[model samples]
Target: MDMYTFPFDTQTCTLTLKSSGYSDKELIFADVNNQQSLTTESQQNQTMGEWELLNINASTTQPSNLVFSQHCITYQITIRRKPMLYIINLIFPVFCFLVLDVASFFMNASESEKLGLKVTLLLSISVLLLILNDKLPSTASQMPLIGKST
Candidate 1:
């Protein structure tokens, strides 16, 4: 087939393939470039390719260093919601707070020990938050997420 075009746009010409699978299914992104033994999965799903033109995110102008003879950009795309980072940052601390809240029950009707326990737990969780912050890298070193010491 002839992919004839005068001005090529990388962002426009390139097609994006997105697929969703069960948690167990291995989501793999394969770049079908050059001559190589086609993967068994590809061979099986040959008729069910997952390439799609970036119609919604179409490019306004032609991209630079355009290259042809290439198509079918496959990516294991997974739908995710925002607030993931915020939730993560708060999950541990929030969990600790919840635990402390329950611990408040240990306090008497009106006593110093009860107040002390609550303060102590809050301080402990404060330290934990700092540790978590330090553990997470400032920049994204790898995909998915940065490795946590745990």
Candidate 2:
């Protein structure tokens, strides 16, 4: 759940299947032909909204304890976000605004016009920051790199 990496981040989620009432002797969990439980169709349906499935690893485990042991099938699913959405919606616009601000300095406008242009650009950037603020959680432990850059 680290958002510090933001658009470049990859998340690994674990899905464990186990029966609480059933022990390993009563119920066993095994992958077909010792292969991953994920089907070909699931692999093909990799893209889930903004996330792109990267890898899936499945394993069976039997926890050793004084009590009855239960069979668990764990799947580690790795997915990376499709950064295009963030790039287009957030980063690109900010970059363009920065470029415009910098280029405004070279414009052959009067001092008053330049000041007004700078003020306008500053307001535009403030509005953009406000929009970004709404998208990110205020309770985050650390600010995201995107936020810092913006």
In the range 72-125, model 1's lDDT, one tens digit per residue, is: 233322212233454567565677688878978976867878878878887887
Assess each prediction's global lDDT (C-alpha) against the native.
0.44, 0.78
Models 1 onward score TM values of 0.33, 0.80
lDDT of 2 by residue, 1-150 (tens): 767888888889999998999877888676644334364546686655878777777888778873988877888888888888778878898899999899997988755788888989999989988887776446556777876745
What is candidate 1's local distance difference test score?
0.44
TM value for model 1: 0.33
The TM-score of predicted model 2 comes to: 0.80
- Model 2 residue 36 CA deviation (Å) reads 6.0
Clashing residue pairs found in predicted model 2? none
